[model samples]
Target: MKVEIHNVFKNMRYKFFQTEDGIYYIVEIKPSFWKTLFPFLYWFFPFPVYKVEDEKTIEGIQTPESWSFDKSSAVLATGGVAVFIATIFRGKIEMFKTELPLYIKIIFLIVMIFCVFLIRLFVNKVKFHDLYKHVNLKQLERFEIKVKPQSFKHIGQMFASYIFFLFFSVMSYIMFFLDGNVFVLIGGAAMLIMFSLVVNITVKEGLTKIEFIK
Candidate 1:
């Protein structure tokens, strides 16, 4: 059977199918408009999905083969862009109370990406950290959904992110008035609003209970 699932905003769609052998496989993932436009920031992230074996896999899902190319492309494109920006604005941008060179900034960005990749790999091991990932055949068959609240540490991290976005938005607004960079204005507003919506969803999902009935 096929079904459509969406998040709180109902902007993106998760298309999935359940086979006779009781395995759930995603057929297609329709990203939101924002994600489609800014694929560099959103599309590269790894989302959790069931480990597909040879017998029960579907076509359109992010199989290992397809994801290899996608991941490489995203990393290369992002790194290239970061290096280009750093090189162009080397003396203009300041860091650690001084202006850093192009090579140093590029190295820092690469290190940050590597650290994030490692952290995501670790998070994928835990089952209940993300509710959406638990929509597998085994969980559905048992009709038991595990809902875990965000840890205080995680909540603190999110709050920090919220503040960071708020700052970025304000700074971008000021800079736009000064120089009128349209890209900066659009990006800042988008980041601020998206992070706000995420925090809103996190706050509202407190102790949500789900039960599947026959």
Candidate 2:
């Protein structure tokens, strides 16, 4: 398979391809900036995007190389759910002291975990259309492509994280209003570190796995 570059938006574009094995490879093109910066900031970015423009040939060999794991999808969904739940409950806990019942906190955490698991399962099952239609006899002849999209999953996760941080910031302010406790400041800093680590690890692992598959 041969890949041709198309137009890009914010570093993302479509890839045109024709497989020698009679399969059509419609892939998303990665933005050059994103790809270059991915190694440093993989956690904040979303899954790349690719599209199928046309098919040149149709060979019938199932190629494993053409089918790569969508780890970014899973990470985004799971992370987003986590951040959302944390932000929501943290806000509630801060606003209404009476609402911070132990049972409620436990229930909220359970729900968040369940949501993350569901998102992970959903991402695992995602598959690109016509992904395996382009495997040729020679492994070297296979076409590999990449794309970067402003993924909703990624954006949602990032937004959720932002909310979580905002919640902490608000808590810090509340603490200052009450008695100027330093613990709130420390807690806010801790949250930032934890969130950054999670994002960085998830993105790096996801992208690494995808590249290995390709």
Model 1 CA RMSD to the hidden true structure, in angstroms: 14.8
lDDT of each: 0.41, 0.39
Model 1: how far residue 54 lies from native, Å? 16
TM-score of 1: 0.33
- What shift in Å separates residue 104 of candidate 1 from its native position after superposition? 39
lDDT of 2 by residue, 1-214 (tens): 1223222111111223333454444333222333332323443334443333333322222223555558899899989997997877674554433334455544644554355445433432332223333422223234443223235665566556656755765566455335433344445445533333233212211222222124
What are the runs in model 2 whose C-alpha is more than 4 Å off?
A: 1-150, 198-214
Ten residues in sequence with the least summed lDDT for candidate 2: 204-213
Those runs of model 1 whose alpha carbons end farther than 4 Å from true positions after fitting are: 1-62, 69-80, 89-157, 178-183, 186-214
Worst 10 residues of 1 by lDDT: 2-11
lDDT, candidate 2, equals 0.39
TM-score between model 2 and native = 0.27
